[model samples]
Target chain A: MLIRRPPDLLPSEITPEPLARGRRALLKGLGAGAALAGLGLPQISQAGSLGTLRPSPLSSDEKLTPLKSVTGYNNFYEFGTDKEDPARHAPGRLKTQPWTVTVEGEIKRPRTFSIDDLLKLAPLEERIYRMRCVEGWSMVIPWVGFPLAELIRQVEPNGQARFVEFVTLADPQQMPGVRSPLLDWPYVEGLRLDEAQHPLTLLAVGLYGEVLPAQNGAPIRLVVPWKYGFKSAKSIVRIRFVREQPRSTWMKAGPSEYGFYSNVNPAVDHPRWSQATERRIGEFIKRKTLPFNGYADQVAGLYSGMDLRRFF
Target chain B: MTFQPTPRQLTAIKAALFLLTLLPALHYAHGLWSDSLGANPIEALTRGMGIWTLNFLFLTLCVSPLRKLSGWHWLLRLRRMLGLTAFAYGCLHLLTYLWLDQFWDVDAIARDIWKRPFITVGATAFLLMLPLALTSSHAAIRSLGGKRWQSLHRAVYAVAILGVVHYLWLVKRVALLDPIIYALVLAILLGWRVVERIRLNGPWPTRSTPPAVQPVVFMKRDAAAALGVPKKR
Candidate 1:
């Protein structure tokens, strides 16, 4: 059963309460009863009505400092190279009003679903993951979304779905990066079938109990925390399952510099510099990089028999 | 027997100056190893060290031009120190590329330098800096003698051109702004030499003198306007 708040109270419930005693006791009593309605986690449920997935409990922050926050804001070079460019350029162009994703390719259910239908397909969950960038800085973001494999599974990929490729919206009017000849328009990223099924990969739609800001890849974006930031492409429009490796944008720019896998292995250095160390975001000094970006325990099994050096 | 220092106390003073000149270059290296570089440290370190290397190379080139045009013979004394400082920073730049970037893999480093156009230009600049650095000592000057030493050191001219080329090639597209500014500054420094050479060979032709003098006078007139003055005829 999902909990459904009364329409009037829903809007006010998300705010911090000043009238504590009366509202707190009443809200607590109502929350207990409301849990019977089968609604997702109430924290995000009260924030918006996007039919967000019911997220898992907030994860622990093992030994990291308290200074963790979004280390970087988006820098959309199409609008301009400035950090605030994406916020200004993204909102008006990527209107979610008529957003829909065509889930075709080799899937049992080949259907085009509206963005609303997609959100309702699964219970939203939140996961705090460390994001490392190829440029040698990192961030810890508590993102709200569910596993991407959950969505892929619902479509029921065919036996030949060895790879899953994500294609971002290509309208030059919307994504200004498409204007420049720097890359093939409509950025694409892919993961091997098993890699896509990894429990850690997230399909993020919101952060901080609010709808994801336009600059933050609103509606939907992939979050593969262990890899460098570029691997998680933004503003996705299509998903294609294929047999061969898809050409990645950064790798196309400089193959020697950016590899296909791009897993954060400190030992395999980039052509221009070593990946052995990275500056923790918001901190002054760079720390030694850990194997698989410190999530080796969880992801190490996936690469058990293969050589990271060759893949990297 | 050694060629003893001229009454200039050349040995002690030159050594002290050499060590002092190394401080700024050393400070950059310290920042690199300690990771004091801000966000995007790779770029910060790359650009920071790269710009300093070019500046030192430019400063080295300036010595001969300033000596010739300004008739400041004493400026010649600092040429070796300035050239060596350029070499030191060049070495640090390459070291960052080696240890930090290639993880000290000689084969991989060699391949990249050979294959990439920008890296090729940068590597040529470093290789050219090598002999210049080796020949910076008084012993090297004595062994080569004055004429040979001057000819070998003329390689600094080649180094300057290569440094600018490397910078231009690294950036995407032509990006004429930065390279153009550096080119203009270098051309002015080189132009001063050309002017000094023509002046020494013969007096400036009357025709060229009139046109050249007009721009200088016009610049002064513009300056005079700021000072609330109409120049007297």
Candidate 2:
């Protein structure tokens, strides 16, 4: 698969050759180690590194957020509610290898694909996308994954499949926060069929050219660049195609604050806080939040005539 | 068991408490210097100061209940200092938001105070604390007269309630455990005062003069006089 770098990206902005080569070597070592440790065993292993990543034209040319910040700060409520809780607790708790994603409901071909199968389905492209949180913060993340459309096409949704729902793992033994009644367990998120099939929508397995850390939804996760970060569900174990709009976890938690569309529109303020501006993760001063998180040219047509304030 | 701290012991205790209260500020400062306050140091600093402000407010409210329960009049000697410390931290919290977070952008600050409910409640709570802090000095208390001063200072309860509400309103509903805990603590403190009021008098207000207010004792009588706190009648 031939991949083209983003036109705006400078040669200097690409990952250094030595670092990329070293990471590739580390990934090879990890694969060997996993094989030696009894390939037949079902026990999950730790995430190490992802091999060579092809730069995609879809990538944002903006400066990448620091890997430390991306890995350290997270909103994975299954681990805990605090931003730092996921990093503190998920490493030792979550088991990621031998993972399988069950694709079912309203699809022509429903099948459970193991993590290895999913990784080999398509070439992993490094797409740097701007991620905006509903809580007035944002990050630029280089996610390594293929378009969700690739997997969707493989499954071939039936006529009845109007929406797709993503469900995350919620084992109490693995996720301590699952014990707390924060939201209904087995966190669920959904997207309209077209939105899910968007070329920008990704099924990310790694970030920053490395296999995702446990805190960052190891094995696989969704990355919907146009929506608020929560709309991109993490540590997904199931994807179900549905006939009707599925109620997401956040919608159930706060219906007024978190709407189904959840497209990043600065005009639609959250009931509690303004969506006008966002503090970029590392920056001190807040910057004006863009409509559709600056993907207006690509996604504005999706919500052309709808009232975002009402939908939001 | 009955225990009463001596005058010298009271001064030492006050001195120790003063130093202890500064620790949270120092910790945030050191975190900033070392670049260890996670991804957003500005947020950590702003939030750390705000939480410490609430802590001091809780500590200030604890004095009355602790004094009444233990029959230790000396605890009142520390109340003014504790209240003042809460005000100090409140100032730092607001400054951090205005300077670091907002970068002294008057339009943005105004927009936040006007548009955001959490900011509205937080700013109102700080505004209400100002008069109480100003009247905290013995001279101002004397000028306002004890009876009127006490009534005015009672606004602290409102400030405490607003502060907790501000916290509750700002956080996402899923992460409300911390704010709810603060609300519960304030409820118990205020409830204790309510139960004490009914026990002392009756449930209803009476035409007759209520019992004498608690004596405003100080660490040293001469020092108290210098500070304008009247001697116990």
Best candidate (score: TM-score): 2
Q: Give the Cα error of residue A64 in candidate 1, in Å.
A: 7.8
Q: Which one is best on lDDT?
A: 2
User: Least accurate stretch of 10 residues (summed lDDT) in model 1 chain B?
Assistant: B224-233
Candidate lDDT values, in order: 0.66, 0.83
Error of 2 at B34 (Å): 0.8
Residue B21 displacement (Å), model 1: 16
Error of 2 at B153 (Å): 0.5
> How would you encode candidate 2's per-residue C-alpha lDDT over A1-312 as one tens digit per residue?
112455676786665566456444654567643453234222224444455467877788676677778989899999988899999999978888678999999999999999888888887778999999988899999898889999999999999999999999999999999998979989999999999999999999888766778898987899999899999999999999999999999999989889999999898888887788889998877999999999999988887798888887
lDDT of 1 at B222: 32
lDDT of 1 by residue, A109-214 (tens): 8788776676666776656677777756666665667788888888899887888888877777777656767665567788887878888888877654345556
In CAPRI terms, where does candidate 2 land? medium
User: For model 2, what is the error of residue B3's alpha carbon versus the real structure, in angstroms, after optimal superposition?
Assistant: 3.9
